[model samples]
Target chain A: MSASGYVQHYSAKVSDIYFIRPIKMFKSRFKFAQTKVAVGALLLLSCLPFAATAASLEAQLSQYAATAKAANPGFAGFSAARGEALHTRNFASGKPDTPACTSCHGKDPRSAGQTLTGKRIEAVALSVSPSRYADPAKVEKWFKRNCNEVIGRECTAQEKGDWLTFVGSR
Target chain B: MKFPTRPVSLGLLVLAFSALVFSRAQAGGGHYYPPVVDPVVKEECGSCHLAFPAAMLPAASWKRMMGELENHFGDNAAVDPALARKITAYLVANAGDAAGQRYSAKLLRGVDAASAPQRITALPQWVREHRKVPDWEWRHKDVRSKANCTACHADAELGYYED
Candidate 1:
C-alpha cells in the first residue's frame, strides 16, 4: 500500500533468507564435524592398549640389542635361530634337575610350560601372549633366576636378545 | 516294648555334640593355619611356590629364610631390602611360635627353637603325616617337588591339608 512499507517488507525477507538460513545451516554442519572428531578420537583411544604394549616390547628389544652390541665388538645382531638352539640345548653345568631351558619352558615356546614346583607358566611366545617381554624388569628378573637354575650362570646380553627375538617372532 | 523317644533324643543330642566338638578340635589343630593375607608376601614368596603358611614355621626359620634370599634354595630370589623387611616382619609376627598359635606346638615338638629349621617337610609331624605317600608319587611328573603341597592336597591353597 505505501513505498516505505514495501521497502521494509523486502528487507525483512532478504534478512530471513540470506542471514538466518545460513547461520542455521552452519550450526548443524559444525555439530556434524564435532561428532566425527569425537568418534575418531574414541577409536584411536581404544587401539592405544595394544599399540602401547607393542611399543613397550619394541623398546625392550632395542634396549637388549644395544646391550648386546656394547658387550661384543663384533656383535651383528640377535638371531632367532640362536635363540631356538639356546632354548632347546641341554647343559650339565646347571642343576641336575634342570639342565636345559626346555626342562621348565618345554621344547616349544608356543606351548605353556610347568615349573618344577607345579606352577603353570604361560606360553612365552609373543604370538600367544602378546604382553610378554613388555616389561624390562620382569624379563631381566626371570632371565636371572632361570639362567642360574638351568644354565648355572646369568644369561649374557647376546643370549638374552636372541631369546627375546626368537620368542617375539613366534 | 514302650517307645523310648526321650532317651533316644538325649543320646542323639550327646552324639551330635561330641561329633561337633571333635571336628572343631581337629580343624583347629591342623586345618586352621591361616594362608598368607599380606599381598606383598604373597606376590614375593608365592611366585615360585605356594607361600607356605607362616604358622608352619618358627619365627627363627622365617628370619633365616629372609636373610638367605640371595641363595633361595638354588635360585636368586633376592628382593629389595625394604620389601624383604616388610615380608620378614609379617612372617615372624604370624610364625608358629607366636603367642596364641597353639596349633603349631606339635609341628615344633622336636625342632630346636635355636636351630630354626627351614624345611616344613622335614618336621616330625609333617614326616609322620606324609609317611604313607610312596616315593613314586613324590617323583611323579605332576608332583615333582615336595614344595608342591597343592599336587596332593587339592585344597592346600585354601589352607586345608586334609587327606
Candidate 2:
C-alpha cells in the first residue's frame, strides 16, 4: 500500500483496540519534560474560567456527583481520583504534537494562572464561573481536541464522569 | 466495545496504525501532516512567524487563502490544486468547529452550534483568562504571540485544551 494508505490503515486498525504500553510510557516521559516554568504559567492562565463562574458552581458540582455516581457505581469515588490523575498525565503519542493537560494546567485543579506562552486558562474545576460549563458543546469540543492531544484518543464517558466527580468534589 | 486489553489486540492495533500511516504516505503524500505554506503568505505573513493554523479557515476561507495569497500580509503564495486539496482536507477534517465539537469543554456547556469556529487562541473567553499574563510575556524571546496557542496550550496539536 501507499504511504498515506498505510497511515490510514494503521490508524483505523489501532482504533479497534485500547491504550498500549509503549505509547503510555513514551507519553509519561514526555509529560515530565514539559513541566517547565513557562508551560506551567500558561496552564495557570488557561484555567481562568473556573473563577469566573463561582455563583452556580455548586449546582454543577451536584450534577456531576450524580452523573459520576451513575456511570461507575462501584468505584465512582476512585474513578474520580483516577480521572484527576489521568487529566494531568501526559501521553506523548506521535499523532498529535502537544503536551499533556497537566503540562499547562497544574497538577492541582485549584490553582489558576498563565502559561509559558502567555495564554490564559481558567481553573475549570475550581469554580462554577456562572459561565463555566455553561455550554456543553464547547466543553465537548475542547475535550475532543485536548483528549486527542494528550491521550491520542477520545475521553471515555467513564473518564468524563470521573473527571466531573473530581471537579465536583473540588 | 470495551477497549482492547489483550497484548495481541494492542499489537494488532499498533501494526494497523503503522500500516495506515505508511499507506497514506505512499498514496500521494509527503509528510503525514505537512505544513501548507503559501508563497505570498510565507514572504509577508510568515515573515513575522509561522502562519495561522490552517484549520482556522473553512473550505471557503481556504479558497480565500488562495485568492488572497498575493496580498497575504503583503506577499503572494498561491498554492496549486493538488496541494491545496490535501491541505484543505486536513484542515476541514480538524477544523475548530468540526473536530473540536467532539470534546471542547467550552462547547459542552453551550448550545450545539454556539461557537462556529472554536479557535481557543482567538476566543474572547480564552483571551480573558490569560489576559493577565501581559503581551510581552507571549512575545518573550522564546515565545511568539498570545495567539501562538501551540506554545502553551497543553494539547494544542490535538486542537484543544485538556486542563
Model 2 residue B57 lDDT? Answer: 37
Q: What tier of docking accuracy does candidate 1 attain?
A: medium
lDDT of 2 by residue, B24-141 (tens): 5453231122233555333332322344545343334454455554354332334456755665565555543455422223322332333343343455545556767776877674
Each candidate: how many clashes? 0, 93
TM-score of chain A of each: 0.71, 0.50
Model 1 residue A81 CA deviation in Å = 1.6
Fnat of every candidate, listed in order: 0.76, 0.17
lDDT of 1 by residue, B76-161 (tens): 79987999999999999999998887657777888887798988999988899889999999999899899999999898887877
Residues A50-157, model 2: lDDT tens digits: 554443444544555576577667644336677788777667671333466776566777765344444446675634333546555455655665566567677766
Q: Please give the TM-score that candidate 2 achieves against the real structure.
A: 0.34
lDDT, candidate 1, A1-170, per-residue tens = 69999999999999999999999999999999999999999998866765776888778778877888888889998899999999999999899989999988888899998888987778989888876666677788889888988888999988988898889889
